[model samples]
Target: MNNKIGDFKLYLSHELGLADNTVMAYLNDINHFYDFFNNKNMQVKSTDIVNYMNKLKSDGYSIETILRRLSGLSAYFDFLIKERLIDKNPISFISKPKGWDKLPKFLNFDEVDKILSIFNTNDPLEYRNKILIEFLYSTGCRVSEILNIKVSDVDSKRGFVRVVGKGNKQRIVPLYNKLVEILPSYYNIRHTYFVKGRDTGYLFLSRNGNKLSRVMCFNILRDACERAGIRKKVSPHTIRHSFATHLLTNGADLRTIQILLGHSNISTTEIYTHITDNKTREILTQFHPRFRNRGKS
Candidate 1:
């Protein structure tokens, strides 16, 4: 059954065009469910699936998380039924959990300054790394997108870089002039580190002459955040959050920012609006005469 399910996952990836990571996640989720049932020494009926989902909630998994796990289970059962491994899909009657309306967390422009300025640019490598950090926050790109950036993708004349996002979707993000000014320095360092026909296309490289791993990028970001004295738990994604929030606070429209961030859904981009709470308070303080003048008027 495990092997059969694994074959179905491969079909989902190759035939249905699901990304590798997504397919793996689905497989893991289903495998976990299977393990849970086996440990209980019982087969999962339709009501048992519901009871398990409820148990997930009792165990403090959020509705969104439960929905994702349930969705994976449904897909797996559907595959089993189609393959005649199961008499019927047990997960067919199960409903998804309701999601909560949660806002995003982001840093202010000053906080971004605090984060970026922590890096010491005494050496060429330091300079390159600092520029890489700035460029990631300035562009609001995923870490995957940041490492994939090439010198030719940057257009100084257009002030943007063509980014290929999730699902092979492409979009152009307006480049910050400050970031553009420092890009050449990184490029110079990259040229120095270049070996003949060895990953000349990648934007960032490691000390081992290999492309920067996501884990390495994340560690670098966490170290920078600690150096910056930022109390908020920060990661590479925090820089991205700050990027979008800062732009929204500066009056960029949601649609344009969404395009710049390469988000396929407006809902995914809406998180930035929540991070502008401080900006909202500042605006009210400046514009509201009652608040500004303290009842003098």
Candidate 2:
């Protein structure tokens, strides 16, 4: 019953149904705690928990990082308590650091157009890259989900694609017909030229015909932004945020967006409401007479 860190990982993966990435993160955090405990030869205590957190903060971890690490410890201690390994949760006494509430970064529609229009479709790679950017913005898919797509997943006739999201849950997101039109151009090249034993099942691929990596997509976005003359920081997520924001601004329902984005929790999708509210306020400020503050005789 006194299983250490290894047992906790199995619990996280099997009992909790956490994804591999989440399980890995939890294991890494607990390993840090176990290492600290072993190094000091001290038993787990509330003070030790606080001290370790303070040490992490002093080591220049951001508030978000500190909170994530603390949250992981809290979950770990909860498991221990349930197993009768601890009488009380030491992490309970640790207060979460105040998280900075910055609005999620997103590009406006014009910014998105500017970025996508940078590519000329003459070259095969350029043609495919243009389609990739269009598909991302049109579908509002996460970069991971986009890259995970298979050629068969796209139902062009239906104007939707079956996307396997977090937890391996599948959802159908509408694919704009305008974006789908680019598929044929890319498909022709993809079909003709490819590396030996390359995967044709994947929807997106590198010049070598292998599936594209996330980092490679990021660099592609960065270069596209530069070509578009956009100075603001941009990433694949920017397109996702832009997709959701544009839909909300044009009056899409919250629930539909949540389903499209494959958010397990609705609260995650609520951030766009805040963005929409801010846009409304700005519009009123610009046009409303009371807020206009015009000069009067």
Candidate 3:
């Protein structure tokens, strides 16, 4: 089984082309389960996985963490089956733990507008900040993808920008006309103020003219959120969640969003549906016969 772990690592890293962080995370999850799996003499059953999941919950693992572990174990078992070691994927029919599909935290449209409104100053840096935030919401991209975007990656005339996502996978997401209209001013500012040496070619630049980093991205969003007076915690990913949720609210289909967001698995993208699920409850509760008389009294 340990040797199989090594093989799976290779499969994930080399064949799947997953990022190091993702590969490391999956390996960690598998190893964490291996300790208990050894007790079953490597002949693990679905009940064994259920018992393990219960143990995880009892030990206070968050729903998100437990779900990640289950996902990793499922993938590992799938790999084993592919190699003809396992007869079946034991956890295939297992239900996700309750609340595992809870809605992700995201800003409403008004909150996003408020955050964007913080860049009212004429300062070139402020323009850059506005562009960054808008770019994030417009693209629905990850921080890594945002940092990796180069000027060449954007094709304004075509109204699409190429983005590289997890596992170095490349996909094209549409660039809104609003973003296109405002890009030139930022480009001019970037060329004049930010650049001092050889250009890094990344679209978003720091004061040093290098590509905007993850920490820089975080600070930019945080500062904007503070200025906008949004009390809730926000990050680049919050903007991402906002992007997906807002799109869903506006009636974008999940498959289109999955492509735009560069999700390798549609299931990974389905988390955003929890918001629609809330809307679902609202509609159901509003019309249900059980609720019709309650407010009347």
Each prediction's TM-score against the native? 0.79, 0.83, 0.77
Top-scoring candidate (lDDT)? 3
The Cα error of candidate 2 at residue 149, in Å, is: 1.0
Q: What are the root-mean-square deviations of the candidates from the true structure over C-alphas? A: 4.1, 3.2, 4.3
Q: Which of the two candidates, 1 or 3, achieves a greater TM-score against the reference?
A: 1
Best candidate, TM-score: 2
Runs off by more than 4 Å, candidate 2:
1-3, 32-60, 87-92, 198-200, 287-297
Candidates ranked, most accurate by lDDT first: 3, 2, 1
Estimate the TM-score for candidate 1.
Answer: 0.79
Q: Rate the local accuracy (lDDT) of all candidates.
A: 0.77, 0.81, 0.87
State the TM-score for model 3: 0.77
Clash count, candidate 3: 0
RMSD of 1: 4.1
Residue pairs clashing, model 1: none
